[model samples]
Target: MQSITLKKPAPFEKYNQPVGDRYIDVLDGVRAVLVLLVGAFHIWQQSWLTPHFTLFGQRYSLDFLLRSGYIWVDGLILLSGFLLYLPYARAEMGKMPPVGPFLLKRFLRIWPSYALNVILFFFLAVEKYNGNGAYMAKDLVTHLTFTHTFFYDTYYGSPINGGLWTVGVEWWFYLLFPLLGRCYKKKPMLTALGMMTCAFVFRAYVSTLTDTRMWFNQLPAFLDVYALGFIGADAFVALRGKLLQSGKKEKRLFSLICLLCVILLVYIAKAQASSSGQEGIRLGQMAHRFPLALCLLVLMISACFASAGVRFVLGNRVMRFLSAISFQFYMYHQVLCVQIRERRLIPSVSETPNRDSEWPWQPVFTLCSFLLPILLGAILTYGFEKPIIRYFEKMRSRKKK
Candidate 1:
C-alpha cells in the first residue's frame, strides 16, 4: 500500500485580541528574569573583587560583571520586538481595525514614568555637569524631545544614567512604528531579512573602522536594533500560525532544531567572550550578538507557539507578575545604585585611592541597594505607570461613548 502524505493546512487566522497562551506569559517571566538579573548586575558593581591577569589586566570588580551584563540590553531589544508588537501584528493580520486609541495608549504607557524619571534625574542628579551650559541645554532639550540619540549627543556627561541610552533608541522606534506596521503588512519576510542584513552590515562596518567615531554619532545605523525588534514582531505573527498548524512530529523536530540553534549560538557567544583578543571582542559585540539576539527572540515566540503544556508553563501567573514588573525594575535600578553610592551606604573597604577605586565598594554593592529600589519601583509602577495608562484609557473610552 502506498503511504499517503496529507497536504499541510493553512495557518490559523489571527486574533483581534492579542492573546497568546500561558507559554507567552512564561516568556514574559523570562523577560522579567532578564530585567532583574541586569538590575542586580548593575547594583553589584558598587564594589566587587578584581581578578588580575598579568598584573596589568583591569581589576575585575563587581562592576566588571555588571558591565558584562550588557548582553541583557540586547535581550531587551529582542523582547521589545516580540512582546510589544505581537498583539498589534496579530490583530492587523486578521484585518481587524487597530484599537481606536492604539497610539494614544502606547504614548501614555511610556510617557508617564519616562517624564517622571527625567524630572527625578534632573533634581536628584545632572548638577555635576562640567560641560558648557549650552551643551547641557541641548542635552536636556534633545532628551526631552527624544531626538538626542538620533539628532544630538546628550548623554555625554553628568549623572545621566548610562542605561537611558536605550530610551532614546526606543523613542525613535515609537515614532516609526506605524511605518513598520505598514511594511509588515506589505512584505514581512523581506522586511525582516532586510533589517537583519542592514544591522549586520552596520555592525560589520563599525567593527572594521579603527575608531568607530562616526558609528558612535550615527543615528540611522543604531536604529537597526529597534528595527530588528519590528522584524521580530512580524516573525512572531507569521511563524506562530505556521507552528501551530504543523504536525506533532514536525513540531517536535522543529523544537529540537530551535533548541540546538539557541544552545549553539550561546556557546559561540561564550567562546567569543573567552577569546578576549581585540578581534574576538569586536566580533562578539558586533557579529555574534545580533544572531544571538534574533535566536532569543525566536525562542521566546516559539514558547508561545509550542504545545498547550508549554504555553501553560510560559503564561503562568508568576510569569505574568514578573513581566508586569520587569520594565519598572529596569528603570529603577540605576537611580537606586546612584543613591546608595552617594549615601556611602555601600562602604568601600578597599584601600585603593579614590581615583584608583574602580569598584567603589570592596564586597560588591549589588545586593545592598536592591531592596529599596525594588520596593520603590513597584510603588512607582502602580502610582505612575498604572494611573497614566488608566487616565488615557478612560479618556479614550469616554470619547468612544
Candidate 2:
C-alpha cells in the first residue's frame, strides 16, 4: 500500500493562524522522555528485580523510582491539553479551522490506532477468559465503549489492556473541549481556576465515598492538569515573540527554574515513597498531583524558550523520531513489556539466582521493551493512522469545495 502524505499548508493559507509557538521541537523531546520513563517503570515493575538490593554496601530499593514514573502520565496529559487547546484557542480568535472539523480531526487522529489496540486486546481477552462468560461480556462492553474508568468495579477489574484507562479520560476531554474553549476564550485565568477547583473538590468528595485508587482514572481528577495546559496555550499566544527573543539572562533563569522543577518532582516522589511505602504511594500521588502538574507545566513552557544547549539536546534527531511515534509506543508498550517479562524471554542483570540485581540483562530487556513498541508504533502510524487521517482530511476539503 502507498504511504499517505499530508500536504503542508501554504504560507498564506486562508485558515492558517499564527498561534504562538507554532511548533516547538523540544516538546517532542519531552514526550520522548516521558514515554521512556513510563516504559522503564513498567519494565522495572515487571522484572525479576529483588525488593531490596545492596548498592555500594548500602541496602536500597528502587521502588520509588519506578513508582515515580506514574507522574509522567500526568506529564503526557498536560502536553495533550496544551497541544489540543492551541488550535481551539486559535479558532476562538477566528484564525483557524472551525470547531467541528477540529473535533473530527482529533477523533480521526486518535481512533484508528486506539481502535486497533482495543480489538487486539479484545481477542486476547477472549482467549484468556475461557468459560468466564459474564465477566468477559462485561469487560468487552466496557472496553469497547471506553466506560471502563467510570465504575470502581469495572475500573479495578482486569483491564483488557494495561495502561488504557487514560484513553477514556482523554476521550472525554476531547468531547468537552468546545465548552472548555468557550470558557477559555472569555476568561483564560478564571477557566483555569475553575477547572482546578472542580478537580480538587471532586477528588475530595470521591475520596470519602470510596478508597479506590482508580479515582485518578476519571477525567475530573485530571481537570486541573488539563487546565494548566489551556492556560499555557493562552500564555504562549500572548508571549510567543517575547519568549523567543528572551535574552541570555532570561534563558538562564528559565533553565534554573526547569532544573528546580525537576528537583522538586524527584524530591516529592522520593518523599512519598519513603514515608508512605509502596501502598501509600497512590495516595501520595493524589496528594501531590497539583504540584506535579505545575512542575510539568513549568518544564514545558521553559522548553519553548530554552537556551541553545537545552534545545539541541531536546531537538535531537533520534528524540524527534521517538516523539513522532510516541502515541503508538504508549498504547502498546505496557502490554508487550508485561508479556515479555512474564514469559521470561530474556535474562535479567542479576548474576545470583535470587533475582536481586539483573543489571546487564535488565538494561537489555528495557531497551527491547522500548524499541519494540517504537517499531510497532511506526508501522501503525505509517500503515493505518496516517492513511485514515488523510482520507478524513480529503473528505473535509471536498466538503469545503
Candidate 3:
C-alpha cells in the first residue's frame, strides 16, 4: 500500500503564509460561485429557448445568456482537476510505496457522500415511480459503482443524480493522477505544462475527427479539462515561487498581465461558441478554453501573490462556508430541479414544443436545484463525510504513532 509522505511545512517566512494556507478556501469560493451560477442558469433555462417575458401581453424571448450557460459545467470540470491535483502537488516530495492507499483514501472521501446521494435519489425516485424495482435497482447499482456514463444505452438521459456524470470523469482523473504525478516528479513545472499541452492536442485531434457531441467521443475529450486543471495547480505553485523572488512592482505587473489574459481568453471562448453551434455551449471543452482557464488560474495565482483584498474575500469565513458546501450542492441539484419542473410546482406559461407535459426544465434549474442539495449535502457532508474523513485521519495518525 502506498503511504502518503507528509511534507513538512515550508520555512519561507518572507512570503505571505496566509495566502498559501487559505488557497483552498479561495478555491472553495470559486466553487460556490460556479455552483450558484449553474443553478440560476438552470432555473429559467427551459423557457429560454423561446423566451417570453410578459407584462400586459407584450412578450419577448430572452434566451441568449441561458443557452450559453452550459459552459459553466466545463469550467467546473476544469476546476475539479485543478483542486484535486493541488494537494497531491503539495504533498511530501519523496515517493510513496505504491498507489493502493492513496487511491483508497480518495475513494473513501468521495464515495461516502456519493453513495448516500444515490441511495437518497433512488428511494425518492422509487417513491415517485411506484414499485418499478428494475429501473431503481439499475440506477442504484450503476451510480454506486460510478459507471453510469458507461451505460449509455440503458439510461443515457436519465439523471438520477444529474451532475454525477462529470464525477465519472473525475474518478478516472484520480485514478490517473499517480502516473501524472510521477511525470511531474522529474521536472514539476514542465511536466505540468507538457501534460496540459498533450491533453489539449489529444482533444483537438479527436474533436475534429469525431463529432464531440457523440458519447463515444465527448466522454474522453473531458480528460483535457481535468489535465488542464492539474497542470494549472502545478503552474500556480511555480508562479508563486517566482513572485516571491521578484519585487512588489513585478508581482503587480504579473497580475495585470494575468487579468488581460483572462479577458482575452473569455472573448476567444465566446467567439468559438458562436462558430460551433449548440454543442459549442461548453466553450471550455474546446481547445480554445485552455487559454481562458489558464488565465483564470494565473489571475488566482496573482491574487495569491499580490492582492490582499482578493485574499481577504477569498479567505472570509462566509465565502469559505459556501465554498465548502458547493460540492455537495453540485452533486444533488439536477434531479431536484427536474422534480420541481415535472410537478409544475414552479409555473411557466411559455411553451417548449415536443416536450409536452414536461415544462422546459431550464438549465437554470440546474442552478436552483443546488440549494436543497446544498442543505441536504451539508447534513450528509458533516454527519457522514466529516466522520468518514476524520476516521481515516485518525487511522493514519494511529499508523504513524
Best by TM-score: 2
> Going through the candidates in order, what is the number of backbone clashes in each?
14, 4, 14
- What's the lDDT for all of these models? 0.61, 0.76, 0.63
Instruction: Give the TM-score of each candidate.
Output: 0.75, 0.85, 0.74
Model 2 residue 112 CA deviation (Å) reads: 1.5
Query: What's the distance in Å from true for residue 46, model 2?
Result: 1.1
Q: Please list the Cα RMSD from the true structure of every candidate, rounded to 1 decimal place.
A: 9.0, 7.6, 9.3
Report the C-alpha lDDT of model 2 over 299-391, residue by residue, as the tens digit. 877766656667667777888888888888888998998777766777644444225555666667767877788899999888888899998
Give me the displacement of residue 42 in model 1, in angstroms.
2.3
**Model 1 Cα lDDT, one tens digit per residue, 285-400:** 55556666766666665655554445455566766676776667677787777676767665555443223554535434545566677677678888778988887778878988
Please estimate how well model 3 matches the true structure, expressed as its whole-model Cα lDDT: 0.63
| Stretches > 4 Å off in candidate 2 | 1-20, 48-63, 90-97, 275-279, 347-360
Question: Which regions of candidate 3 deviate over 4 angstroms?
Answer: 1-18, 21-24, 46-65, 91-98, 127-137, 187-202, 205-211, 216-219, 242-251, 272-284, 346-371, 395-401
Candidate that would win on lDDT: 2
